[model samples]
Target: MLLETTPDTSAFMIAGYTVAFVVMGLYVASLFIRNRNLDRDAEMLKTLFEAESSPSSKKEAGKSAKKPAPKKKSVSKKK
Candidate 1:
């Protein structure tokens, strides 16, 4: 009777699973970091927007907008 035995591949399987989990963990961690950064940026932008929309800033913007352009001096042509 000739019987073939199955080869042991458990070690390779474990290694592959470990590598996959590690990569997944790193990806999830990076996503968390990016989400936190985006939230922080959103808050910062909101504050800046509020500051720009304030009455004091509006008055300053209005003053600048109401200014007239300076007259340009023309050069006299010599014949």
Candidate 2:
């Protein structure tokens, strides 16, 4: 009886490698997007905190020395 030779499986191996590279590329891209979003959030929160603190502190400091305006007295002459 003659023996049959098996076909090479290199094509299947190459396809698997391609799929692995594509998946890794996608994962790296997602990580980059998440890092950018976190940086933006941090910058926004810092700005918000500065905006919230400055005006209130100034108003509080002014409150200690500020006086209310004097009211004018009404004069009634017989008309």
Candidate 3:
């Protein structure tokens, strides 16, 4: 009669699970950071749009418009 022995793979299985969980955790953290950045950008854009579309800003821009500069006299070169 012959007896069969089973091989142990518990350590490899544990290592694989640990790596998978760590990768998933990092992915979740990155997504949260991206969402926060998007929120900040959206707020900044809203503020910019509000500034550009306000009546007072338009009036101020029109009032402070720069005048055209005078033309300079050109000197002719002899050929």
Please identify model 3 stretches exceeding 4 Å from their true place: 1-5, 56-79
TM-score of each: 0.59, 0.58, 0.58
In order, what lDDT does every prediction score?
Answer: 0.63, 0.62, 0.60
Candidate 1: list runs displaced more than 4 Å: 1-3, 57-79
Model 3 Cα lDDT, one tens digit per residue, 1-79: 2576666888999999999999999999999777766766665565555554555656666433422221222221211
The reply for model 2, stretches above 4 Å from the true place, is 1-6, 58-79
Candidate 3: pairs in clash: none
lDDT of 3: 0.60
- What tens-digit string does per-residue lDDT give for candidate 2 at 1-79? 2576777899999999999999999999999777766666665565555555556757766544432322222322212
CA lDDT for candidate 2:
0.62
Error of 1 at 43 (Å): 0.5
On lDDT, the leading prediction is 1
Residue 48 in model 2: shift from native, Å?
A: 0.9
RMSD of candidate 3 to the truth, in angstroms, is: 17.3
